[model samples]
Target: MKPLVVLVGATASGKTGLSVELAQRLDGEVINGDSMQLYRGMDIGTAKITADETQGVPHHLFDILEVTEEASVVQYQALARQTIAAIRERGKTPILVGGSGLYLRAATDVIEFPPTDPGLRAQIEAELESEGTAVLREQLREADPESAAVIKDARRLVRALEVVRLTGRTFTSFLPQRNHLPSLEPVLQLGMKIERSLLHERIADRVHQMHSTGLLEEVRRLDAAGLRKGRTASAAIGYQQFLRVIDGVLTEEQAVEETIIATRKFARRQETWFRADARITWLDTACEQLIDQALEAVRG
Candidate 1:
C-alpha cells in the first residue's frame, strides 16, 4: 500500500503553506484536519485557506458544514478515510494537513468504537447543560481517571465520561486505533515546528489581520442566524471572544487581547497533544532544509 502523507503541527505553524507546496510536488490532494475549518462562512476566524492559497491544487473536507452543525473527530475519521481511499483509487497521495491532532490521529488509528446508548448520551448532555462541566469532570475522574488527566477541555472530558457511562467500557478501549497502522499503508507523519516567541507573534498578527478583514462582522452574521456564543459554532477561537464583544460583555480591545491569549493557550495544548506521538517527524519552519528533509522521508 502507498503511504498517506500527514502534516501535523501547532496552530499558525505553516502547515497550510507547506502542505500546498508538498501537494504540488507529490501529486497529492490536501485533506482538511482542522476542526474549525470544516464550517462554511468561518473563513476569517478559522484562518481558512483561500482558493488563491491552494494554488489550483484540490482540497477536501473544508467548508462542508454550516456553523450550526456539530463536527466530531469520529466523523472526521470516517470521512477522511473515505476521502483518502478515493484519492488512492485515483492514484494520488492523500496529504492530511492541519494542527488538529485528534482528527489526524483518529484518521490513522483504527479502533472499534463500542456501541452507544442514545438515552444515556442524552442524559449526560442534559447533565452537562444543567450541572456544568466541572461536575462532569468529577464524574470522568471517577470513571476514567487516566483519560481525565489527559483530556483538557470540559467538552472532551464530558464526552469521555459519557462514553464510559453509557457503554460500561473504558474510553481507551476504543482508541490506540488500529486503522492508523503503518503496515496497512505507508504513513509518514510530519510535524511542523516553530519557535515559541515566533509562533506567538504570528498568532497575534493573524488575530489582528482577522479583525481587519471583518471577523467581527462574520461573528455578527452567525449571531444573527441564531447561533449563540457558547454553542459549538462559537467554539472557534476568534468567534468565541468576539461574541463577548458583541454581547457588550467585553470591549473590542479586551476581545482582541483575549483572542490572542486564547489562541496561544490552544497552541500550547496542541503541542502537548502531538508531543506524545513518537511517530511524527518534526520540521522547523525556520530551517530551509525542513521541506527537502520531509520530502526525502516521504520518498523513503
Candidate 2:
C-alpha cells in the first residue's frame, strides 16, 4: 500500500485535479481537508468537487455539517484521523487534499490544541469587530509574532488571540514545527507550486466562473438555510462576498470583484502557510509530468 499522500496548495492552484490523478495511481481515496467543504449545501462557493470529478475514487468527510454549525479543528482532527485509519484498513491509500493548512496538519501532525473557552472566544471576537483585525493582529504580533505574520484574516487572528488568552501560551506553539512529523504513519506531503501571475489569473477566472455558475444562488439557498447563523460557514470567501449581494449592499459585479480579491489574498496566505513547512515536496502545477513526479516522490 502507498503511504498517505497529502496534496496541498493555494486555492485554484490545481490541487484538486492533481489529487484525482494521484489517487488513480496510488489506488487511494481522497479526504477533504478544506474546512469549508465540510458543510452541506456549500458546494459552489467552496468549489466543491462533484461526483464526476471524483472519477470513482471514494471521498470522505464532505457535506458532513449543516450550514448552521461551526467547524472545529479538534472535531475535524478526530473525524479525519478515523477516516484515514479506515482507508488504511481497506488496504487503500489515503490522499489528504485541500488548502486548509492547520486542519491538514492537525490530521497528520502531533498537535496538542489548547482547549477553548467559548466565553473567552466570544469576548475576543467582539473585540475583533469593535477594535478591528488590525488591532487584534497587533496584539497577536506582540504575543506571538510567528502566528501574526502568517495569519492574514480576522477569523484566524481572533482564534490565535483566543488560544493565547486561554492557555497563556503562544498559539504558534500548537503549530507544527519544521520537522513536520506525522502522527499516524509516514506522509508524503506535496505542495503544488505555480507562478504568482498564473495563480492570480486562475483566481480571477474562478471567481468569475463562480458568479456565472450561480454562486449567488448557492449563497441565497444557504442563507435561507441559516448560513448567517453559523459563524464559520458564513465567512467563507465566495459566500461572504455574495451575501453582500444578497443583502442588496453590493451588486453581483461588485461581489464578484470582491470575491476575486479576497480569494487571491487567501491564496497568498495559504502559500505562505504551506511554504513555511520544509517537509512538503513542491510540485510544479503546470508540468505534464506532475503525476510521475509525485509517484517518484512516493517511491523514493
Candidate 3:
C-alpha cells in the first residue's frame, strides 16, 4: 500500500495554493491530476502554475505534451503510478493534486478499464470525422439512449457505441471491478469548498485574468499547431469559448460570459460528483480554522 495524499476540488477553489502549502508542510512532491495542465503552451487558459508560483517545489506532468497529442486516462494512470512509486521509494510523500475527477478516479480506482478495440475505435473515429457529431449522436440516441444521455460528445458517443456494437453489452456493463489502494498512513483526501456566489465570482475573475494574460494568443498557437476548436482538448471550457470567438462565431465579450457560465456549470458537476464519494473529507473554504483542521486530519 502506498501512502498518498489527495487534494480534490473544482476550478478556482484554491486547490493549487493549498496543495503547495500542504506539500511544503508535509515534505511532499506534487503530481498533477488536471488534464489541461498536461499540454505544453496552454498556460493562461488552463490557469497553469508558473515556475514562480511553484516556489522551488518539484511538480510532475505539467507541460509534457503538445496540443496535437492526445493523452488518455490510462496513460495518465500509468505515469502517476510510476511517479508515486518513485516518490515513496525516496521516502517522501506523494501528493496528488488537481481538479480532474476522471483522471484522479482513474489513478486511484486501481481497476483495469475494459480493453479498447483499436480497429473498432479507429472506424468509430473515422465516422465521427466524416459524419459529424450530430449525426453520430442521433445514431447513439437510437441504439443506447441511456449512454447517449451521459456521453453527449460525438467522440465519446461513438466510442460507447463501438463497445456496445462489438460486445453486445451496454458500455456501462463492462465497468472495471472497483478496487482501492489499501488505506495506510491515513490517506488524507481534502476537498476545498466555497459558497456558490464566491466561487462564481472567483471563476469570473480568473477568466478575466486569463484574457488579460494572453489566453487568446495561446489558443491561436494551438490552432496553428493544427488542433481545431472542436477537438477533445479544445472542447475544454475556457479554450473552446475563445476558439469560437476567434472563428467569428462569438464576440470577445460574449466568449468571456459563456466561458464563465460553462465553468460554473462544470463546477456544479464537480461538486455533485465529489459529494457522492464517501472517501472525501470536505473542508469549507470560509472556515477560519481551515488550515488547522486540514493539518489535524493529515497528522491523524
Better of 2 and 3 by lDDT: 2
Give the alpha-carbon lDDT of every model: 0.84, 0.90, 0.81
TM-score of each: 0.89, 0.87, 0.89
TM-score for candidate 2, residues paired by index: 0.87
Off by over 4 Å in 3: 125-145, 175-186
lDDT, model 1: 0.84
Give the Cα RMSD of candidate 3. Answer: 2.9
Model 1 / residue 94 / CA error / Å:
1.0
Whose TM-score is higher: candidate 2's or candidate 3's?
A: 3
Q: Over 4 Å off in model 2, which ranges?
A: 119-172, 180-183
Clashing pairs in 3: none
Candidate 1, TM-score vs. the true structure?
Answer: 0.89
